[model samples]
Target: MQHEHWWPRPYRFDALLAPGVARARDCAGGIIVVKQGGVPAPLLRLRHPHLAAVVAADCHHHVLAWAGGVPMARLAGRVPVAAAVRWTGQLLAALACLHDAGVVHRDVTAANAMVVGTDAVLIDYGLAAPPGSCAVAGTPASTAPEGWRGHADARSDLFAVGVLLYRLLTGRHPFPGPPFAALQRILHGPVAAPSTQAPQCGSAFDPLLARALAARPSDRFASAAAMAAALDAAQAAFKLHCAANGGLARVAGECRKNGNRNDKYRERERKYRV
Candidate 1:
């Protein structure tokens, strides 16, 4: 069952090309992986590094992406609302490309994405499948409830994105849990407005995310483009409100307190924050 989902093994790629295999002298987090794969290094040159086909000595020695960046999870409660919003746009853009290709990235979580410089790249396509191959793929916390019982379409990806965005902006997951508890939370938990947890998010931001995180697929945004537009509108509204209220800087202070921590403000203040 586990192998069923393994990314194509290195031998699969090796038949076409072989890469020199070298093991890292040291391992991170106390796990050392001696690599074993037949795919020649040249083959990787032709493939996207993140999706490269390099099998490990065991079953999990897969190396994903040649780049390193901070996982958004580690940046929780430090990401400002504005910074979160900016990242959301980039994520949506990446999804648009996937949806255009008729694929659904079944799994999209903070662990699956990394923030580098000012942009975020969506990673971990091992579970990405065409529409109608529901099969319950993806992290439990991020999976759409319908995925457990039906085919998850593009909207399903949007739902996962919504979950991510919510966490990014609020620091707290709309549904929190370890496994069964988290699944139950996703299935039966409350969808509180983002503002409730992070006032910096502003009330306008809540409605848009609410629709994205809606339990019912039909209740969510119709598409990634729609979600992006709604996000843009919310940002505009927030800006106007800030202008009228006379305290635009206040939002960043609360972000420091908690509520999806991020620090985009230090770069250029509110112009592109969130």
Candidate 2:
């Protein structure tokens, strides 16, 4: 199994027949081989822009899949604003599709994302589970609060998307720390405005980011589609804001020039009178 990631894949394998096998390696472990054989029936039937199709998988030791291009983590800061927008749309839509298919990705980190040309695909399903399962599965930085209660639903995955969003826009995790400390911050710390952490960020995202990072699931956007819509609107507003600021600066510059001219005229009159 050739893998760009020398770590455990997100989707659990060899588990239906033996439930805990993946938990040990998939939960807190690293570098899982992406190999060939028995993909689950539900996964095979699923179709989403951000998802890597499961080609085959047996009960326990195997799954051959076609995941997309380079890991998103590698291309984080390198992605252009325009390309990031496209990726965001695909990612949210794909997540919505996955939820619609009755699956919860649980793990939605950048390393699990692959950018193949114009498309970005989410990979590593080994830690994934059906919605409502309490057992822990996901990286510390991206896990939702509900995960601590041993329950993660569609919204749980949404939380991870929020984290991914923060990373994509700022190239920094909303919560940064070692594994345990990171999870702690997620559970207790207040979420900050993205602009506060990254001054270059547009303020239009403040409200949307707040909702996405809400501590309670109900407080967050109802679904991935809804979040995507909000983001679209915010991005639009951001552009408008930038345009307005540019206009204001230009006007200010003109006013300053006019004032300078007036000052010069007043000085000339005083000298002539003398």
The clash count of every prediction, one per candidate, is: 21, 24
lDDT of each: 0.66, 0.65
Roughly what TM-score does model 1 have, to 2 decimal places? 0.73
Off by over 4 Å in 2: 1-40, 61-64, 247-274
Worst 10-residue lDDT window for candidate 1 reads 25-34
**Model 1 spans > 4 angstroms off:** 1-65, 257-274
Q: At residue 213, give the lDDT of candidate 2.
A: 77
TM-score of each: 0.73, 0.73
- For residues 129-161, write the lDDT of model 1, one tens digit per residue: 678883777788889888777688899999888
> Least accurate stretch of 10 residues (summed lDDT) in model 2?
265-274
